[model samples]
Target: MTYPPPGSGYPGPQGPYPPAPPPAPPGPGYGSPHGGGKTNGLAIAAFVTGLLGCFGVVGIILGAISLGQIGRTGDRGRGFAVAGIILSCLWIAAGITIGVIAANSDSSGGSGAAPSATRTKPKEVDAQKMKVGDCINDNTTASAPSTAEPVEVESVKIVPCTSPHDGEVMAVFRLSGLTMPPESQLRQRASDGCKIRTRSRISRDPAANSLANSYYYPTDESWRSGDRSVTCVAVAANEGTKLTRPLAR
Candidate 1:
């Protein structure tokens, strides 16, 4: 073999390869191994808002927007968006159901019904049949009896005074005439009579301050139906308290 001179054919290794061409600039969809797309921000928001019941509607709208964004931008979190939408839908449905039930209860006079431990239906009775010292539950729609309008007594349940009762009858009196008086005059008379009766029955005590008088009198329709008696009752000043004894003098 002929010997070649050193440094002539293989150039003595003075320069190293050229630094490898700068690593090829990392290709098309590079940095993240999974994909270059980001997780959708609106998708995350929708999920968080859905967990809070009050914002369920808003969450549904946001979840829809997130799905559109993910479809176009190749973003992640489609599962989150779907879950948020489902949760929001269920929340709305529950709210609607509760509202319907509440509306039905109000329409059926359930709001005016007395609280009974036994849940017995109120018994219908003539207004004249209510006597003094009777503990009764008045299931009438009228919150306060008015002389202007005939207050119809729908039903009454006579319960023991010791048990939970609505009101205690203090006095029973007659308006005394074939013709009914004006509503304002009748209301005034009923109010005055109830006040007198309550004062006469209850002595000056702290409980007296918390006692209020209510009266039921004949309306024009009731008067035509042969109802003439006015029933006075002593009730708690605030709701949820029962008159546990006769309030009459």
Candidate 2:
């Protein structure tokens, strides 16, 4: 005799199982529950600005905001937010480095005279080392005086003759005597010498005509240190005007 199936009484086979319940409706995709799988708008903005290397600070801010939003709302573009932040930080660092280098280069100077490149860039020059062709920008508060004086100055900003400048060195000469002279006598000597040297230049160059004579003489302190040179400068005839071209031939 044949054994009967346990679930059925003497059954040879069981009916096919009912079709597996239709795949549970696919659950919302990852990061789409509330976000609907859309990329964050701020993330795109951040990436674009960072890639361009402009508005780096703004890009960093936008990336931070997007990252927070993606975490909370489960939106896409998290990678973009992180990349934007990294790129923005790098750009900011690079910009700072360039600025520092430029500042240091502009502030540095050699001893005797500015480099020949002074025609294209600005450089600092020691007052006693100024040469006849040097063009200087006046940053001091005092108005340009027609007469020369014995004023104490450590250095001056030498600029290109093509650029705006307050004065041009017309002459460089040394005063006589081992001892420092009185302030009035020194001033008078400097004024007269500067005027005599610049007379022909003013008559020849119309630009020089519009300028007045000025000078830089060593102070007693500088004098004792063997500073005997005087730099005769041609300044604007009028207080506010500036020289726009080279006064030298």
- The alpha-carbon deviation from the true structure for residue 218 of candidate 1, after best TM-score superposition, in angstroms, is 0.1
Per-residue lDDT tens digits for candidate 1, residues 1-249, read: 877887557644566545445566755654543667788999988888887868959989999999999888778888889888888888899999999999998667586776555544445566568888777876553323222244567557887776677777778887777888998888788878777766766555347777777788777888898887778877777755666665535
TM-score of each: 0.44, 0.50
1-249: candidate 2 lDDT, tens digit per residue:
877667666433355545556677887656535446789999988898789888859889999999999888788888888888889999999999999977777677434446656447778878888888989975762227644323457888888887899888888988999988898888888778877887888677866556677888878889999998878888788877888888757
lDDT of 2 at 207: 66
Report lDDT per candidate.
0.74, 0.80
Against the true structure, candidate 2 has what lDDT? 0.80
Question: Pairing residues by index, what is the TM-score of model 2?
Answer: 0.50
